[model samples]
Target: MEHEDPLVTAEWLKENITAPDVRVVDATWFPPFLNMEKTGRQAWSEGHIPGSVYFDIDAIKAGGTDLPHMLPDPVMFSSRVRKLGIGDGNRIIVYDQFKFFASARVWWMLRVMGQKDVKVLDGGLQAWIDAGGELEDLPPVPVERHFTARVRSDLVKDANQVLAASEAGSHTIIDSRSPERFSGDAPEPREGLPSGHIPGSICQPSGELRTPDDRLKSADELRTLFADPMAPTISTCGSGVSAAVTALALARLGNWDVAVYDGSWTEWASDSSRPIAKGAA
Candidate 1:
């Protein structure tokens, strides 16, 4: 499905936040390696956009997997989001404390689950504050809304599919990890996981797509960064979080065909059988 701009400005959200048909979601998250003292829920409890519910990426994930924040089943997704008062016909707006970080992951998750009108809050919480938006510690009591998941398989890829793309050279694999990590110079935050990237994948650090002010770069700039706008691309990151940033950037350039490798590096490196390549792509 063709989606309108996958982003909404803080001013736009501030104006429509109270609308019955709108739901604002806070997707704040911190990598486990950071050793953050406060969890995303704790951060949300302190202050958040008024009426916004916290969408914990870590909690709302596929069960029975050692993987970090893997996509949950449709039934789980539908049930969890329903309690957030997110359902059909409601426009969902997601934001994160760190600008465009975890919010894009949530946005991508919603999109892949077939939510027609999900968008990230451009510049995230800071943008909201800058736009004279107020924050409230009190959480809203959300009325349940039924959410139906018409899973969009085209938007997601598994390890086998990514490996085939890497071998056949039919698709472009875009790794969103940092240059050091992509090149094997830096150790992975996850212990015992070797550094380096998938064979033939190109490194496009997600941070580079963001401007100095924490907003995404213009579409023209993003087009240049991506090089080939029409390539069938699969975005991958340390786990699967930042890859959504790449997907969002491409979607901003009117390229919605980009698929995210859901398991990403963590999944790829976990198994010794997968081929790993070092140095530049």
Candidate 2:
């Protein structure tokens, strides 16, 4: 895919929010830490972008399996997206509260569903507020949207492919985990999961991609972060969550070739049979 740098800054969005066919999606999702137990949804109910639809990753997902928020079946996804009032010709903008968090997941889902014109809001919500932007008390009632699914298998990888890539060094597998978790010094946030990282993967915690106001860093800053030229360069994190944050940062720098390991370290660590490395890659 010929990817373009299509970010709309908080200022940019504020100036042209009423623009036609420009749809904003609140793709906010968080781990248990932020009390994913309650607040994410409540926070949105309290305030959000007017005319913006909540693109709940947990909902409208293929979630029957134990695998965390995996992509839904194409037809199922198509229907769920249609319910969101999103259509083929619309320009989609995704954002979230946890810095870059789940917005990338929505972006990736759109790509898999074959929507290529989507972009991420640089800096997300914290940036919006710091910039003194407006907020909406009631969610927008968007017109029904029609969407098509473009399942890009090449853009997604499983544990086995990642393992092979690890040994071959065919691509850069950037782990978007904290230095502590990456170093195996601190256990995974998810209970019972093993410590450490996949062999050959580099530690590039997702936090580095953000600014003081919680917005994505500059293009030059991001480009220098993932300076790998290998094929199939990708990212991963616990249960494939924060990994999407890494993908979004890469996409902001126009690095769309990167993919998220859907089965991430959670899956990799689940099977003790898989090889593991400690300290550094």
Candidate 3:
């Protein structure tokens, strides 16, 4: 399938599997509700695409941040990418087995750092497997190449910034949590956080971007997904994880100003002083 942007389908990835300067990264992650019994590293060891590297989303994170998996420093992120066999010139194809989760996070992270040619593998690993693609018993030993990270600060925002925006009504906050969670009808997965979303935020469950078979929906469908009173949005979710998916979806649509609320609702609701809206965003 051809896209106007830089997405590669399973069939496209399979055909390009052996191409030079092409790198595939497995950005798989599970929510607290769905543990893989082991981490993605162990999963990669058991079996992964041949010549692929594992991009541990949680491990490569911003240190010294109150939130989980905040963006890592530019220098640190660049070093990590190089160690993973990625470079500025290479085309990146990222995917995750758990439908659409951390895969988009990787895609967004790379693109934010000004890597113009990165793309997500449509449908992730399941689609690859269904397409008769082969797998390997281990990840390839990568010869480290230089992957530079130019910090695109505009693409990210901290909890404080989001709080300020919520008060001033300067930007639309798009919460990627389930409707029940956003509405306070469901308890948050992370303890100590109050139920509900930020006042004035909009609810667009990140899972809406996925098709029935776990493939990413077409851009046309995505355009419809973001159509709401909420415009010019920032994305937030349970502890800033899946919220990145919302940012990724927006980025794919060329919303360059989008940001991921680093602390997300976990930090927001945990602080009783922060204002919240109990029902409907």
Best model number under lDDT: 1
Write down the lDDT of every candidate, Cα atoms only: 0.91, 0.79, 0.80
lDDT of 1: 0.91
lDDT tens digits, residues 3-94, model 2? 66656788888887788988888887777654565566666777887777887777766666776777777898888777777888888888
Candidate 3: residue 138 lDDT (0-100): 62
**TM-score, per-candidate, Cα-based:** 0.98, 0.92, 0.92
Q: What's the number of clashes in each of the models?
A: 0, 8, 0
C-alpha positional error of residue 236 in candidate 2 after TM-score superposition, expressed in Å? 0.3
Cα TM-score of candidate 3: 0.92
Tens-place lDDT digits, model 1, residues 1-281: 35578888988997898788888999999888899999888898899999999999999999999999999999999999999888999888999887567899999999889997888999989999999999999988999998989999999999999999999999999999999999999999999999999999999999999999899888888878877967899999998999999999998888888999999999999999999999977
Better by lDDT, candidate 2 or 1? 1
Task: Indicate the worst ten consecutive residues by lDDT in candidate 1.
Answer: 1-10
Give the RMSD in angstroms, all C-alphas superposed, for model 3: 2.4
